[model samples]
Target chain A: MPLSAAAPRRPQAGNRAYLFITPFLVCFVLLFLLPLAYAGYLSLFKDQLVGGTVFVGLDNYLRAVQDARLLDGVLRVALFFLIQVPIMLLVALAVALAVDSGLLRLANMFRLGVFIPYAVPSVVAALMWGYLYGPDFGPLTQLGERLGFAAPRLLGDSWMLASLGNIVTWEFAGYNMIILFSALRTVPVERYEAAAVDGAGPWRIAWHIKIPALRPALLLCLIFSVIGSFQLFAEPNLIQRLAPTVIDSSYTPNLYAYSLAFTSQQVNYAAAVSFLLGFVILVVSYAVLLLTTRRPRR
Target chain B: MTTTIERPRSRRRTAAGSHVARRPRSERRSNLLTLGMGALLVYFLFPLFWLVIAATKNTGDLFSTFGLWLGEDFSLFSNIQATFTHNHGEYARWMANTLVYAVVSAVGAASLATFAGYGFARYTFRGRGPLLGLILGTIMVPTTALAIPTYLLFSKVDLVNTPWAIILPSLVSPFGLFLMWVYARDAVSDSVLEAARIDGAGELTIFFKVTLRSLVPGFVTVLLFTLVATWNNYFLPLIMLNDPSYYPITVGLSSWSAQAVGGNGSNAELLASVVTGSLLSIIPLIAAFLLLQRYWQSGLSAGAVKE
Candidate 1:
């Protein structure tokens, strides 16, 4: 329905509407806005022995620009995003299309089975995968030995990112698929009938009709996936126990800020790092929004 | 226009019906799709399957036996007993903590979202557009980036290390509010509100008596989403709470896994408990997801398709 048709006629409760919104606005300001403003406030100062807490005026952010560890962590997650998100989204798209195709039997079972992982906490998922990735006694290694060849070191320095990516993909692909699948369900049946009458097969119809219609939903998934990529933490943080040599304190930007504040007690610099990370996310998310939405114009 | 509320179900039926009508000519293609789905299913389910199997084995069997098959001994019951009874029943405490945090946050967040969403949808007020824009804008901010500052702010107020730290931040869910805004715009009609007002009902009464009934599905959807999010939350609690007693199952299990791997050799026994605890922690959530599958799926469609 067009939104204008649904616009409220005259302000029935006008200012009284504040009564309903007050509760949310209260929490929003206290929990979200206050901390955000405080973080900005906290970022400008430095705790130095001589001054005991002097306003440094963006010194932390200046240091962040030149900080090798922070830069490396950002690059690492950017690479992770480039490689993992496409593979994950493609898998989710394929599965969602397959389920929507009506060719699969017990589609709901497949849907639920895939979505079950999403319900499992990331902490649990990480631990389960960690146990399976155990070098000496993990199931994969034992299976490899039984098959008479040494298995590749999944938790080794060389493959840790890929291993982390796999776990993330395993956890979230089903969720993206569900989003796409529901979007598919909302397509009017008349569209399919029109395509069928035109002699298009299912594959052709899917490629031409369904996929094009899925652009907005796909864009939604892409933006969320981008945000998730930047905020990568729990999997690496948990798996750090098993592979300490490979994953360091600054493994991801979020992890970097975490250790800086909690372990190193550098709350000032950590606040700066977090603000920069949040800024990066906003810029990238906006860029994605522009790029995806711009394409349809041509 | 009343059909707007019922549209999702009817649309789903037509979508499913169309597929059945086209089934006869695609028998060969159907087999291929089925095979593809079967492989995807295994990829999705294998880790969960491994978790369940590993939870059934003793610590020795976890390493010594074939990872896929049953161990020499059936230690499932013993494993459950040990998981719950370990470390002075810490696992149970964590579970209780998680349940309280999740339930309270879900109810509060959903209720708040409903009222705000309805107010935005059905009533005209000052700052509506800008306020909604700000709320939507926050959704782009990565939550982990906010964790440190939130912790610091909470600490200043002496709310850190308490359940309030976790529950307070969780109660403001931008995505939930956005979902409700879209849902309420369609689900609740202006005419209904107008009639209730003409009959001399107060705004709050109309909401509670009239609007709230129609918004139940959206409320449940937001509730389930927040429940999962709060239950699965790790980073916030890990940083905010220093006391072990306040740990949720996520932080608790991670601590145990750390002990199993990084601790001296004797602490390796916690490995079995970790696996069993991981399995136990997920059962209730998985059950909730499966049972509420329909509501959430519709919720996603309402949010996604409308946008």
Candidate 2:
């Protein structure tokens, strides 16, 4: 049904198409490809004190493989991905379904209220959450005191990760809900009618029809969540000030790479670490695509 | 059969008119659902509510009073004043810089994505599949992974600490291109272009006059996305720019917060400024989102659900 397939092909049209795409291609090369290549090239060498910069091929990567700090950050984010992504997606799915069901009062208000956080910048979200997690002056802590109970120090070493996860979830759940809700809107009303004819109620229709139609949108959200989790930086980096003891420079891989290059002057090593992290992200996303797509659909 | 159907339909009409009394069970369920949504709304809006309350308090009351309640003094105007005048009006400069970057990058990226997407959708060129695939594949690459390397590359060309360093990278959005590609395919019909061709309009002319009009929704979607990305960008600008003048609101507010947290006693006053500045920075974006909600939502569904 595309125009390209329907219209007769012209000889010059193919060549002329390049004219339109060239600007984007030039930028893509300069910004995306060139930086990736340079990062790869930078990853191969090590900056040494005695000999200045030396080409130590694969050594930086090998060291990264054994580097406990880097690997710990990777594992931490993997754990974060496992815990935070599901809760956020589930919440998003619940909110989207509620809005779509038309059973709740003031659905539009709820949708917009939830989505307001997405418009807030991550830096500001982190800052706001940091203040709220303040042990001494935070409203939640003050409320706990009024209620005659000791609130857990949210920014403490044990609770820091969960607090960061809450910030991320708060920022992203509404966004993911919008995506899912939009997809839900595209589902035909006839399906609901047909399901009702078959003696299905709202709960049964949602479980059977609505959810099955949401798989592609859910997968898209999952892949994005995976990428976002692996690239976690701003929240942890900003919150580090409040929980300095809990969050070191190597708290997340991206933060680790940042501190490595900027603070430690290990630019070459930082590139290697980031490249490896990128590889892990690629593999994880690929695996997600594989696992989700490989399932047999009815 | 007609009487049987009429009997049920007449009864259903009355039931619909008096549904609350007719279906008490469903009514209770709906009430429960509304209550749940209210709880979720509180969870979502509590922080923003806290922010609004926090901005009104002075530095002393900020530490002394409850975060959710108003302090004895309402310093919202003075806090806003302090935020703007801090460090010789650096916050205003950052706001201006962010506007330029976001507006320029949004316009550039949207224009480029529209052109490329139109080209991809309308033409069958050599290596089209691979080229499009390459663009899509770039989306998965973590943006943070590229920041250090992009910084390295930009520094070599003496572009670091400049607006170009931020603007150049922000202009190339693979996701925007993909969204437009999907949008253009469905939005612009072949017959329209054919009609324009017969009228002796050039390809570029047809694109500007015809294709662009239909693609406005998609273009606005990409523009808003790129606008938000550039406006909120932190990692790239943080690594690229060292000068305070070039900082976007995100980076500027971040530095102020950092100073508030870790600086000496003199900088303790910056905490109030940070909260107020954040409140100011987000207002325009949230307003834009609310105003353009119709376009972006439709554009998103068009690009995503159609695919």
| Candidate that scores best on TM-score | 1
CA deviation > 4 Å runs, candidate 2: A1-12, B1-24
Instruction: Give the poorly placed runs of model 1, Cα more than 4 Å off.
Output: A1-8, A296-298, B1-25, B263-266
Q: Candidate 2 chain B, which ten residues in sequence have the lowest lDDT sum?
A: B1-10
Which candidate has the highest DockQ of all? 1
Question: What CAPRI grade goes to candidate 2?
Answer: medium
TM per candidate comes to 0.96, 0.94
Q: Tens digits of per-residue lDDT for model 2 on B245-271?
A: 999999999999888888466488889
TM-score of 2: 0.94
Task: Let me know the DockQ for model 2.
Answer: 0.54
Chain B alone: TM-score in each candidate? 0.94, 0.91
Residue B97 of model 1, lDDT score: 98
Interface root-mean-square deviation, each candidate: 2.3, 5.1
